[model samples]
Target: MKNVLVTGFDPFGGESVNPALEAVKCLAHLKTETYAVEVREMPTVFGKALDCLYAAIEQVKPDLVICVGQAGGRPQMTVERVAINVNDARIPDNEGNQPIDTPVVPGGPVGYWSTLPIKAIVQELNRQGVPAAVSHTAGTFVCNHVFYGLMHYIAESKAAIRGGFIHIPYLPEQAARQPGQPSMALETIVKGLKIAIDVAVELEEDIVTMGGQIS
Candidate 1:
């Protein structure tokens, strides 16, 4: 059976509850016949996020890793297609570090494509009536920082592991304060995540489809 490590960031940006974290916590005891799932809680800080992720990787030695983060105002579960090496945080991280125009890894590749079957996961989620799509950008915040760092580690170590990032919308309570901002139910988010994990563990290649955006 394959081993999969799923990670979610702690609440950040003045939020009390992060949907990603809550959903991941719910999945901690998930059992499947083909693969075992492990959950890790990562700080929303830039550098420390990667540190926590790396430690979990070393401990879990997972075959696949899916790092999840909360993306306020987003209406769907976006499976990121690529992770840029830049960190241009519009707001400070949980540690109060607001880095602008900084490279996640000095002299590293400009970006890294996700090794996960992103399209397949999106397709499966959509088929299950969950709002999901392939997102081209993970944004230049701690989310991207962790995503880029994870992919870079895999490249540098040449490990046989597939890793990617997913962004989830805010929870219903979170949007209640924002008035018009969209938020998904916690149970729905958890259902989507479970489907995403299933597709990631079972599908080896991504399915080609029309999951793109236009300016």
Candidate 2:
């Protein structure tokens, strides 16, 4: 049985339920006879989120890592293609810290391409009738911060961890508050993530082939 580490953030932005964490928890139930899944939650702050995520990676030492976050304005599940080295948050994080034009890692490269098979994931999601796309930007918020940190850690560490980030749309409740926001049901998000995890584990061979072409 292979182990997979799944992570999501706790509620931020004055919301009661975060679709990121909710979807991760829902997908974590796929622990079956052939695979083991572990789900962890990280803080949504700047300096602390990356450290917590790396600690979880070290502790779990899973075969793959998928970090999920909320992108409220997006209309669908977005497979983020790059994590940039910037922290220009539009709103204060959970710790009440908002950074403007800050580097995610001082002296790190400007960006990191996602190690996950994003196009394949998008195809898989679309096959399931879930709207999905390749998102070029994870935003300059904490999501990008954590995503950049994960990629940087993978580049520098001895751990052979494959890492990527996914941005989910606003939950129905969240979208209801903002009249113009696009909303997706929690169940659909869960199903999409399950397919993503299944692909993350079951499609390693395809990942190598497609990843080479992508690079």
Identify the candidate with maximal lDDT. Answer: 1
- Assess candidate 1 and give its TM-score to the true structure: 0.98
Off by over 4 Å in 2: 205-215
lDDT of 1 by residue, 1-215 (tens): 88889999999888899898999999996889988889999999989999899999999999999999999989999999999989999999988999999999999999999998999999889889999989999999999999999999999999999999999999999999999999999999999988988888888788888888895
Each prediction's whole-model lDDT (CA): 0.93, 0.87
Residue 112 of model 2 has an lDDT of 94
Give me the candidate number with maximum TM-score. Answer: 1
Which pairs clash (backbone N, Cα, C closer than 3 Å) in model 2?
none
Number of backbone-clashing residue pairs for each candidate, in the order shown: 0, 0
Candidate 1: 10-residue stretch with minimal lDDT: 206-215
> Model 2 over residues 2-117: C-alpha lDDT tens digits?
77888999999999889999988876657866568889988999989988998888898888889999999999899988999989999999999999998999999999988887
Once model 1 is optimally superposed onto the true structure by TM-score, how far is the C-alpha of residue 20 displaced, in angstroms? 0.8
How close is each model in CA RMSD to the real structure? 0.8, 3.2
lDDT of 2: 0.87
